[model samples]
Target: MVEDPHALFDAWLHEAEAGEPNDPNAVALATADAAGRPSVRMVLLKGHDERGFVFYTNRESRKGEELAANRHASLLFHWKSLRRQVRIEGPVSPVSDAESDAYFASRSRASQLGAVASDQSRPLDSRETFEERYAAADARFPDVVPRPAHWGGYRVSPERIEFWEDRPGRLHHRRLFVAEGDGWREGMLYP
Candidate 1:
């Protein structure tokens, strides 16, 4: 058995990345706003380590504000080609400022500009308006654009992680790891 749940998670993710045709790193991120209403959207997993799973977004965006108000979040990683999935729930925290800067620098110039231009989850008058905003940002920063102060990464330190693998006859294999006081407890469940 993998001593750490994260090790197992890495192995499974690697397999999914190799076998899936597209967007293998995509996951559904779920967050709840101040009113306790939940929202979910597909976001790319940029990095993962012992600290937890990492993703980036605008600090003022809907998900960002939700996470700020309620530090709890969950993620679902589905690989339909392999009929497997992984779910993680945890407390969210902003990744180190240095980490965020490095990742931001690695993004394409156009994407960096797009991030600066987008008021994610906010109403936009039209696609043209959005494109015009992007154009303006591009013009404003004709060189290497600095990462927006309001954009960065968050790390979700999971307290629970579950893995599901499909089997024949509608049966399935399910394993879960729940964080205890210091470590984690692993158990299997009925499919």
Candidate 2:
């Protein structure tokens, strides 16, 4: 077994991607604003490594604003197909512009346009208003759309992670790794 839980997580994620029938990279990200009010919603996992987990969003969005105010965050991945789940809590930071640009360029043309068109987490009058802006964006950038300044990515460097698996009895298996001052401390938990 790999000594580092982060490395083990990467391995498990890879396995889940291969084994799961759908949205293997989907994760529920949780963040709190300055007021300590928490919010969570599902987002796709863009990248992961020793540094952290990466996901993209509009800088002006509520989640983005919250992350900016407080860099702490948590994440959860539930794989029903494998009856397994992983939870992570960590510090958040913006990804490099180069990274954001690369990911934005890889997205579909319409998605690129939508990123520019939508004022994410902002109030809108109607669907017509939204579609009108979307159409305008499409017309404005008929080719080679540039990534919006407001759109980018965030990476969470985990301080703790928990892995859970279902067992025959009600006693599910649970393992957790906590970040110590310079390294990680691992332990098992009763389910």
Candidate 3:
């Protein structure tokens, strides 16, 4: 009787952290514009709780633009080592400025510098140009690099969550949780 998707997600995430060889927090983020043209890319899950799944990005990036145009988004977490996947659909909202600042502060100096230097989804004339920009940013912030204004996080407030686990003979297990008021209603789906 797992009524709370967060609890289930936590359990699976812990398992993934132990079993996955690489980034356990990696997730495929899907976003679409108002016209329904969908796009997806990989991003690291920075945080999660009852509030929803959180990931940071450049607000000027393609995904960020799409999120702004249409707040609806979806996240998929797949741990091939465990043969488990979780799908979450929800509306995304910007995290508090304080939250973004805190996370930015926690990041490595190089990462912070890179965030400031990189133009994200924008085109680059050459790698050297990008590196030069990064070098300038690096020189600008020799210490205590501040988070760029365009860099922040988004939280997907889930309306529905589905958990899938592989089973023998292709008889997989699937459970779905739909938000209901302050709680959730769980149901099993045929797999």
Which structure among the candidates has the greatest lDDT? 3
Q: Pairing residues by index, what is the TM-score of model 1?
A: 0.96
- Tell me each candidate's TM-score: 0.96, 0.95, 0.98
Clashing pairs in 3: none
Candidate 1 lDDT over residue span 72-139, tens digit each: 99999999999999999999999988999999999999899999899988999999999999999999
Cα RMSD (Å) between model 1 and the true structure?
1.2
Residue 20 of model 3 has an lDDT of: 99
Kindly report which residue stretches of model 1 are placed more than 4 angstroms away from their true locations once superposed: none
lDDT of 2 by residue, 52-147 (tens): 899999989999999989999999999988899999998999999999999999999999999999999999999999999999999999889999
State the lDDT at 98 in candidate 2.
99
**Candidate 1, after superposition: displacement of residue 171 in Å?**
1.5
Candidate 1 vs 3: which has more lDDT: 3
How many clashing residue pairs are found in candidate 3? 0
What 10-residue stretch in candidate 2 is worst by lDDT?
1-10
TM-score leader: 3
Q: Please, what is the whole-model Cα lDDT of each candidate in the order they appear?
A: 0.93, 0.93, 0.95
State the displacement of the C-alpha of residue 117, model 1, in Å, after optimal TM-score superposition: 1.1
In model 1, which range of ten residues has the least summed lDDT? Answer: 1-10
Whichever of 2 and 3 has more lDDT, that candidate is 3
